[model samples]
Target chain A: MAQSRNADGNGVPPVGGPGAVSLALTVNDITRTVRAEPRLTLAEALRGPLGLTGTKIACDRGACSACTVWLDGVPVCSCMILAIEVGQRRVTTIEGLAEGERLHPVQAAFVAHDAVQCGFCTPGMVMSCAALLAHTKQPSADAVTAAISGHLCRCGTYPHVIAATVAAGAETKGDGP
Target chain B: MNRFALAHARTIADAAARATTTVADAMTAARSNATRPASLIKAGGIDVLDLMKENLLAPDMLVSLRDVAGLDTITEAPDGGLRIGAMVTLGALAAHDMVRRRYPALAAALAGAASPQIRHVATLGGNLLQRPRCWYFRAAAFHCLRKGGGHCFAISGESQYHAIFDNRPCAIVHPSSAASVLVALDAAIELVDADDTIRRLPLASFFVAPGRDTERENDLRPREILTAILLPPPAAGLCTAYLRQGERSAFDWPLAEVAVALVRNEESLCVHAVIVLGAAAPVPYRAQAAEAALLGRRVDDNAARAAARAAMEGATPLPRNGYKLPLFEALVHRAIMAAVAETL
Candidate 1:
């Protein structure tokens, strides 16, 4: 939770000048320092600067779930959050979900249930479902819908998404992962 | 898209000190800049960023409140009430065990709002304090009264989404779906000023009618921030519910919504009642007559019908919004009946 930035006198005025800022972010158990444009959102910073483009950017605003990530354990639209303001908070993107190619239960359910169509909204949907399953091991159908309601998919694949979430919960019933 | 410069605040006190003082201050700040400079109170930036990209908003400076510590908590008061911080996101409040158990209506309202991603980012303060979502206001071409134009186009133009009650000069309806439930629960808001001065007032008193001031919707000024929402403990034996009937399940504003919170006394008689109508007025309409109709009476089918009938008594419909009256009446009836049945 501790973060510090260098006051390099590179601060630009209100309109347009310098494009980047010195930011320190701890993402997925790795503390990485990067210079990002002031206009660059956390989503863009992770995808562009850190080379983790798994965090998609669909609406470019908070409305779409393509850029969703867990900021300090709470899922938020990374596009809405400025990269510089992210400081040293822990960020968990979809890239951080698996351990050495072994798919997480949510990911396995998504694969087993054929939830990814077009695959653009998969990262965000999987992350949101994982967050829900983290809190509730066996969530009902309504809970799954509410969890993913903030995400929008033009593919119209809600039924499959719900199935994947329920399957993930059932698979984790023994270990309660 | 052009580059956006930043004015970051290190603390809440620092942020408040840098904010413009009043409407006049905002206008002056806008003129002093080479561009259309305005203050975007960065409460989660859920709605602000979208409005900006849509060109509906182009503020020169963004004053962020996210750095304000102690403004993202959900705690139970010693009096058994709940105090929700302004910066608390809809997802956090909805997932809170206390909110889910004590005020199920509030939890339901939060859950029913935008998608999971949106709920995760949209703050409770921004959800209530955000402006109405009138198409005329959002579209740059319309330039309606809400956009500082002289006439409200919703009256003469496309008004299918306009108000059904308490709209005088402007007919735009309030866009908050959570506010209806909050007001129905007799919630109060804790407003904090730049000087650290604070005031706690009922949520109903926070809204201003269009007849009073079309230029603004609430009593909030430039420097004041909605710090907390205080929900009085649910009355004993109460069962509250929020019914929002919208054009679509997700992302669309409510066409008609009702929030009913009621409790019966030891004698199985109505002791407390609250009914609020959404998408009907400039603000969340407190169904005063409907509440009066149910006072001290058994919340049976007949009483619910009478209350619903009285709810639409003061509605003044426009050309096309006349349909909202019946819709709102039926919604209120259903909500009350559900609440009553749960209490039994």
Candidate 2:
């Protein structure tokens, strides 16, 4: 195998390792170094070595959005991305969705609206809904449904999820004043 | 997934050098009829990672294009043609103002594909070159022909979601929703070889039919990289639409899909038409007969039905999937009507 070589002056392209390499990932605004293989997924790394297990792995594939997280503030499947490939992008999981002691508006709304049945799909659901509220504060019911469309809640919490997301968007302030 | 060496290529040249070694290993393995692990290139790692986890492909090395510069932008040419880099995500492509206004069909195609998370992660290059999501091919126990095995399990097994037109060799339907719209827009693609040689050809030629070769879906090899997509300038009086039906409303594979592009003369007669079907066959199936049937005719309900009928001329549906025949015909009619409705 070709080792990490700085062939040109392009500033260290192949910087990781074939075995376990230390990665300085800026997850949730804090930089932490974790030793992992190139094949370890971001979700696996986040759950195992980092000990941040809020991001649940249901399907372990792209079929279910139970593993959704924020890559540079946009929602993406954490299970689908390799931890090493994340490079310099900021990662935000469910653990980073709130501030100090205040729950995120979507999280509060989920509690108020009884949106957690099995609670397996709640973390990723909250991430997608919170991302939607950040963009559109007064999102329509259809928009809320579209926001969490990728999420598969076998607990049949879709109606409550939509209602909670809609109320969360309405309660919170949007991008503009 | 097996442990593989990962290389983050800072430049395209760096990637090209790695591709040469990968292609060498691939050719050697192919010649020996051995199931040896070879090197591969991946950017988003959306579908490739899935393939790897399923034990379908175990690469020895992975040249990551995650941070490759100059391949993630969308630029408009001096002649108003659009040049989209391969690394552009579906979400970015659909949200572009130029794409939404000039090519509504393409915008629709990109919007209707996958989910919000997938759209943000999976690139357009990976979408076009993605492998078919066949049950037999995906399962390790089947050992289908696409994996260089003996038989196609879908032929005698559960084939409800299989192909209707091309049912002899393999029953797996192509899964790209944007490909049909791109073909309707007459897009071209750029592919870079291992020697850093760039070749641009029509996007239509990029696909390989199951009858031609059941082993591979597209012409891309593990060593080649799909670089860019070039969309020709929007035609005068061009109106287009893409419509698809899936089992579920969101984040689902297309059950029946159609993309229709047409140019109408001042007399309300169709002068040009292009109809392509997605998830219908092993390739983006072009309905040449349907296009010919609509030329120089008024795009009324009668004409639309006739053209849709013409589109299903050679369909040979399997026993379990004969429902797709009517589904495709109705989708074609709706797609044409949708495009015509946009004109008003």
Candidate 3:
């Protein structure tokens, strides 16, 4: 029930109803405590209170995967999820995809393969690829497309997104896309 | 800023307490700003959140049935039926070995929605409860009959996307892909009332036609939470599949979709058949006339074509959607052929 001083800055009421939800969400093995309205979307909580803007919100609706994040090892649209609902679950955002500023393989491949354009959907594309790689060391070409199809890049980065996902999968096995 | 809220429901009673009022009450409250009434029922935020941002929905409070607990499991009943928790994600159900093998049609429907990300978040309960994807209903410009207006604009307006059957008052097609498939599979809905009382009804009975109530979509009352869906196991020797002919490969509503489940006897003659059409009416249009054609006949090419034609028998087309008749005819043929191929 402790207050966190209106952390999200949106000034919206709590999604959890009148009280600050006290909990810690594990982001990339780092425990960060949050005091937020239960209604706070995971995207807002991560980018606002936590100052991790790597998780972007393209459509705010679940349509675009620009707000993708890893929840309990599964890739999900962060904008559609409530922060309090996450509770003590593990949340790995695009910011958490790397190990100490060393670019995650997905992020690196995104650059090597020119998988990013306008950089709006890059963060989500990276996070989704990371999650796909975690579960699948070497996914088929269709698997890569399905993994990132939910994400939309208005700049027409779909080919690159697909390329990046395939590249990441290949990298997991020390091969090529 | 548009923000989504999640209200936790500790139990069915708690969830009902947090649910929106009657359809009339919800519309009034939503229009009146005192509450904005912008909340959603979160079983799977997959389709719900999309409608919200599209301005098709503006719920003020999201009742999170996720915490209602026990709503995410699939259990086998003594009657050899399957009871699926409302909170169970489509991915879970589609991937469940039993469902994939026993109810391949359901798995195909789930896999057709969006991508793995959506299938992972969309719940069976939410899938069945999703609103129609009619252009007139979703857009803010038109005051259609389904929106409680006097006339159904789709009857004459831009209705290539409207219903092809049950074209009386409203013409918007049923948008729940899973519901159509479930209906063909002969499932039932499990409901929990505001007073915590539970009830069950056949899945086919859950939807109401616009001819019956132009303003409402389903039979759900205010404060009634759809807790789970129970599918009586597929009939013996039954083969099922859902065929959706969409405008695109991803994230688009079906222009015309077909759900077919057939139970063939030892001699390869049909004993039971259920065919439901989506994007063809206000509710899932069960092609009873078409099903009747297959009652005793062997499902050959001629029988499949005749059944397909029978299903489209009473369709009254709008100006733009006249093409749907022939398109649906083709889809129905494909569905029947696929279902028939299973025996081979």
Candidate 4:
């Protein structure tokens, strides 16, 4: 929070912008400093500056969920938030959803059920579905439906995604999200 | 999106002072080119970023309200009502226990809004003030009336998803469905200006008809910041419901929406009623004639049918958007029936 040109006593002044600024961002449990423009979106920063292409950017707008990421454990469109505005909120992308050398339950189920086609919306879809399982132990089909309602799957794998999410929820051994 | 300086404010007064200054600069710039906002206030950045990306309004500075204290909470109001911070996200409002149990209609409206990701980041204040999703207005290539052009392209061009009522030169419908429910609930909004002067107004008055102003959507003054939404105390016999018809069940903007608030006695006679239509007009269309048909009468299938017919009165739909009439009629009837069925 202290890394700002606008750290005046009254309040923060206008920081960053129009020019490239060195900004620190915590991604996948590691804080990486990147130099980028203020107008650059978090999705762009993650994929470009941070070199994490796992978080795809299809629409580059909020219309698509291809850029979905966890901002403090809640699913939000990465394209909707400015990279500079992410501040201290820890961003968890598709890359951080798995354990060491092991895919998350939702990711494993996606593979098992063949829920990937073009795989453009896969990362975002997986991020939202995984967030749902973190809280719901046994999410029903409707719960999965509601969780991924914002996601657009051109592959028409709605049934497969729902099945994979429900199976992942049921397969979880303990309270882990 | 243009590269702009991000200004953070810690207090309401600080935000307002910076906001007023920003607006003054923005208006001055608007006088010449009117291509962008000089300095803009951003809540969730959902709509603001959309505008910036589409080249509608670029800002030299964005006064971020994300750091403002006490603006991201939901607490009980002194009048025994719910005081929702302007920054409260739709996701939090929908998942809130009290909002779901006591104000089911509001929760339902919130649930039907946008997608999960949008509901998580889009704030209440930002939703109320979001720009119309009209294609012409959004496309930078075409300069429409809202964009300081002479004519509204939707009036002569594609208007399949446009408004059916109260749309004059600008045919685009209001984008928010929650604004309808809030008006039905008789909510109020608190606004604080740069002078630290806070004032409240009925939520109904907050929306601005296109006839009144072609560009501005709501009564939000650039110099003022909406701090909170004050919901009235729950009435014992009140029943409320919100329903919408859209292209898709989820993730699509509503084609037509209806929100109803009815206060009926134990015998099921209506004592008071409010029916506000969303995505059907330039603002939340208050169907006063529809409400009149239900006053002092037993709310039944016959009453619902009569009110539905009355609600569609005075509609002047443009070409290719007449389908909204039947959609609004059906939604109003279903919403009325749905509101009454809550107690059952």
Candidate 5:
């Protein structure tokens, strides 16, 4: 039973009890450790200790796709998964999708297509589209629609989102910059 | 949400032991009318986290079963059936090639359920064991009969989403679309008790009606873990189909859903039939009368309509939910017709 100190220098309790424990996560290809309670969700841990505010948490429940994140290359609701249960899986947030100053194909296409309005659901929508493109190089319109079906764009950018994802999928296939 | 201890179980034995100890504590606490559960098992945490966030459930301890080995594989059983681990996510189940080829109804049900994000994380066992999505039971403000309260709020208020059959003292419909298809396929669930003893229960018998027990929805006892689900080998010339009519085309619970599995003879005459309706009753409502109507008869359009009429024979709908009767009848007709058409 190992214990870690919190940021405030408080003595954290050992793991497997009703106290905070140190959890190591591989986020954006970097191994970051944070001490948090067992009940904390992956979304909360990422936003709080990891400071990855790119993943939004509009609905704390699993209904909203605002907290979507890639867990082991699959898009899952981070708000529904426990931080402690993430164990050794790779986590990719919206902030990790871009390389340096350049944007991922999905993000660039989103901007080009003007798919974002309020921008609250952009991160999640981008992550989902990126995951779809990571698997399918040339996704059809229906495929892109099905991929982002869980996400709710209150700004009603659905048509543009579909166009951007389809265009990004084709761009990825063509190896375009 | 309330603060509670968390226990990570690395083995199924360890999880059962922890659950057994906690169930005893929970039983003792129940004597004092404690609202909090003594312990809960978290597989995927989709439903558990929602209940916790809504303050509907407070557990003293959470026994996490994610680290348990051999709980996430889908394999072929010795009898040519499929053995799906309890922890296999809904997305994986729907996308599995074997499931798509052999159990298309189950795949369709899974694909239509919840959303892409939820299906990626929600496991089969958790989906089957999850609580009802009734507004009254989900909200902390409404102490419905399922929550150990004296009265059922849905009976008198907002009965549109409530059950239309077998809803006595409680009106919440069973929310698992997968379970309805599984029941039609005659699936069996494997359970591991705290003593390491294994038990198998037919999927149809797993859900308990409100008349039998108001506090719980299923037959799962304390200190028991649903380890796997076993699907029997497909019968000869068997054809299955699932159809759900939701309010929305995507990411919405079914207003009325039906799954039909029928085995036809070489001449295209029905030999056996099973029709299970979901979100229409407190349990997966088996249309036995409808099945009888299709026995030994050619499953033509006229016969399908007749069976559908028989399926709605004894449905006691609430004042607000009578619309479900016609809706369910239409689904039943479509499901049977589609299943019969598949045989051709």
Candidate 6:
């Protein structure tokens, strides 16, 4: 069994003890390194040290998709993942959706379809929809619904969200926007 | 969530070694101290993180198996079966063309699970080993029997979502929808112990009954890692289907779920059948009486109804969950009919 040791080869405290470890991650195409406790979640690390507050934490648990992010091109609940486990994977949050001032197709479509009501679940929904459109250029209504099924919108903006995702999927198949 | 140390295991051996060492150190420390810290293995962290946030589990060390290599591959076995690694995510399993074409029941169960984001992150092994979502057990206020308390609160308290069958001292239903389909498909689990010795356990004997062991829901020992799940080759003329009834259409636990795998003979008579029910018991309940009812019988309304009725022969449901009996019957009947329809 491997024992916990510091960089100088000194015996450190057992795992889960009060000790800070250095974590390096590539978030939104920038390499970032931060020292945090082992218990720090990716969502906490992103919002706290990385200053990427676009990924919101609603339920904190995996039940809600409020803290959704793209890990290695797949959508995952950032709140459920430990910061240390992220390692060298590419992390994409809600703030990374656009290229600059211009909004992503899904983001633009959400605004066009009036899908944002409370604006709490918008980031996670956009991330999920963006990931879906990244893989499927022309997704059906059912596909769009399945992509964001885990998300909870108290304002009941599901119909608009589905319409926005499908429209964005269609837009991706066309010319540059 | 409590403060815990984290250790990333690079290999299966490393993960087992770290878990064993951590558990041993915790035990040694407990001998001299009043508190006994625990160690837990995290694969997907979907369920573990929830339990930790709820204050249900507070481990001293979390052995992360995420960096472990070769534990995420799903390969076809030499005997024409499928060998799925423990770390395979539900989304990948659901989207695999082989799984969709060959084992439609398993595919349906995977697709109908938690949500798209959850399926993308939740691994197959972690999903099977997830703790019960029973409100009494989840809330730290209630010290139920499963938490090593004296009594079970769900027995006399609110049990609308509790188990209706195989619920004795505890009433929490099995939370895994994949378990019922796996049991119907006759899958086996491969476990690697702390000593690095591997053992294969039949899926039927994996989950323990509630009364048999209130402390643990499964037979997996501490520091033992579930490495892979082995599925047998599909039988000829076999057709399978899965059906679940939940309060919401998505992101909700099933109230009653059923999986049926039926093999028909040349004359359209049932040759073999396995009917498994979920959310109705503490463990996945295999309806032996129902399977027997379908033997040598045509896949018609009468046979389906007979099998469905036989499934709940000795079910003793609680006051609130009595509706589950009929729900199980209907689901089982529908699942069997769906499977039969697939053959046609």
Report the number of the highest-DockQ candidate: 2
lDDT for each candidate structure: 0.79, 0.85, 0.78, 0.85, 0.85, 0.85
lDDT per residue as tens, model 4, B1-344:
76677777788877777664332234222343454336678899898888778776667778889888899999998788999999999999999999999899999999999999999999998888788888987888877787667788988889998888877888888888789899999999999987889889998897778888776677777668999999999788899999988899999999888999999887778998999998888888899999999999999999999999999899998988988888888889999999888874
Worst 10 residues of 3 chain B by lDDT: B23-32
Interface RMSD, per-candidate values to 1 decimal:
4.5, 1.8, 6.3, 1.6, 5.0, 3.7
Worst 10 residues of 1 chain A by lDDT: A9-18
Q: After superposition, how far is residue B316 of candidate 2 from its true place, in Å?
A: 0.6
lDDT digits (tens) for residues B32-125 of candidate 2? 2254545677877888888888876667778888778878999997778999999999999999999999998999889988889999989998
lDDT of 5 by residue, B1-344 (tens): 66766766666766776663322123222332465347667788888778888876667678877878899999999999999999999999999999999999999999988889999889999999888889988887876677667889888888998888887789889989999999999999999986779999898898889898777778877688889999999998889999999888899999999999999888878898999999988899999999999999999999999999999988888879999989988999999989977866
Q: Per-candidate TM vs. native? A: 0.88, 0.95, 0.90, 0.95, 0.94, 0.94
Chain B: TM-scores of all predictions: 0.93, 0.94, 0.91, 0.95, 0.95, 0.95
DockQ of each: 0.38, 0.73, 0.34, 0.72, 0.45, 0.53
Compared with the true structure, what per-residue lDDT tens digits does model 3 show for residues B1-344? 24445665677877776676533234432233543463445666666556555665556566777766798999987788888998889889988888887888888888888666777788888777777777777776766666655666777788888888887877788878888899998899899986889889998887888768776678887678888899896677888879998877776778988999998888888999999998888888899989998989999999999998998888888888899999998999889999999864
Among incorrect, acceptable, medium and high, the docking class of model 1 is acceptable
Every candidate's fraction of true contacts kept comes to 0.51, 0.85, 0.38, 0.81, 0.60, 0.67
Q: Which stretches of candidate 2 lie over 4 Å from their true place?
A: A2-15, A175-177, B20-37
Clashing pairs in 5: none
Name model 5 segments beyond 4 Å from true: A1-15, A174-177, B21-37
Q: For residues B1-344, what per-residue lDDT tens digits would candidate 6 score against the true structure?
A: 77777866766766776554322122222222335446668899888778778776667778888877888999999999999999999999999988999999999999999988889889999988888889988898887788767788987888889988878888988999999999999999999975779989898898888778776778876668899999999999989999999999888999999999999989998999999999988899989999999999998988999999999998878878889888999989999989998985
**Per-prediction tally of clashes:** 5, 0, 11, 1, 0, 3
| Error in Å for residue A120 of model 4 | 1.3
Query: Each candidate's root-mean-square deviation in Å?
Result: 4.2, 2.3, 4.5, 2.4, 3.9, 3.3
